[model samples]
Target: MKRISLFLLLSLLLGATVLYSQNPETNLRVVSVSPNAASLGTFGMIPTSNYVGQASLSIPVYEIDLDGKKFPITLSYHTDGTRVAQEATWVGLGWTLQAGGCVISVFGSNAKIYSANYYDIKGRVVKTVRSNLLGGYDITSTTYTF
Candidate 1:
C-alpha cells in the first residue's frame, strides 16, 4: 500500500509539472475609457477645459499590445453609451506593457495632450502622467514596484 501511494503521488506531481510548463508566464489585459464631457482647447496647453454639461459622447476604445516596444498595436471598438473617461477632455487611445506593469494612454484631440497610467504587477495604478503634443509638459519616467 505504501509503495502504491508513493507511485500515485509521483505521477500526479509529474503531470502537474508538465501542465504548468506548457503555459507561459505572462499576463495581458485590455483597458478602455471615454470622456463624459469635453471642451475645446489648444495644443501644448494644460487641460483646464470646462465641461459644458453632462452628455453622452461616442468614443472609440482600443486594445493595445506594446510588448515593451516603442510602438504599440491597437485595436479599436466603437460602442455607444460607455462613459469611462478619466477626464472631461481625455479619450482612451491605446495601452502597452512596460517594466513589469501596464501603461494606458489617453488622447485629448483639441488639446493635443497625451496622458498615461502606470499599473503595477498586481494591476493597481501606481502613477499617471500627462503630456503635450511634443511629448512634453508633464511626461516623466518612473520605476515599477511589486
Candidate 2:
C-alpha cells in the first residue's frame, strides 16, 4: 500500500510539472533584425552649435494576436539630447528598454520587437529602426540640429 501511494504521488507531481512547463503564457517570443543604416542617411542639414539638438520620433502602435484575440502594443519615446529612449508595453504584460534606443519586452505569448539607432556625421542619432508586428520595419526620423 505504501509503495502504491508513493508512486501515485510522484506521478501526479510529474504530470503537474509537465503541464506547467507547457503553459503558453510563460513563454517568451522575441523578434529582432539588423539595422539598415545605408537606406536611412542624413537629410541634408549640417549640424551647428547654436541650434538645440533635441528631437523626437514617432513609432506606430501595433496589435498582437494571442489565442485568437488581438491585443494592442504601444510605444513611448523619451527624447533628450543624446539620451533618446523608447518603451514598448502590451496590455499589462511588461515593458523593457535598452540604452536609450529600441528594445524588446515580454508580451504574454506573443512576439516581441527590437529596435536600433542610426547616427549622423556628428555622432548624433538621426534615425531609428524597429521591427513591426507584421514582419516589416518602422522608421522614425529625428533632426538633431533644430
Best by TM-score: 2
Q: Which residue pairs clash within candidate 1?
A: 34-85
TM-score of each: 0.18, 0.18
Model 1: residues with Cα > 4 Å off, grouped in runs: 1-19, 24-29, 35-42, 45-146
Tens digit of lDDT per residue, candidate 2, span 33-119?
A: 222211111111322232566343334477668799876544423233221332223321121112123332222322222354433
Tens digits of per-residue lDDT, candidate 1, 1-146, equal 99999999999998886464343333333233333212111111222223633332223333355676543323222222234652433324322112222333433222322355444433345444421222232223322212
> Which segments of candidate 2 are over 4 A away from where they belong?
21-146
> How many clashes does each candidate structure show, in the order listed?
1, 0
Alpha-carbon lDDT, every model? 0.34, 0.34
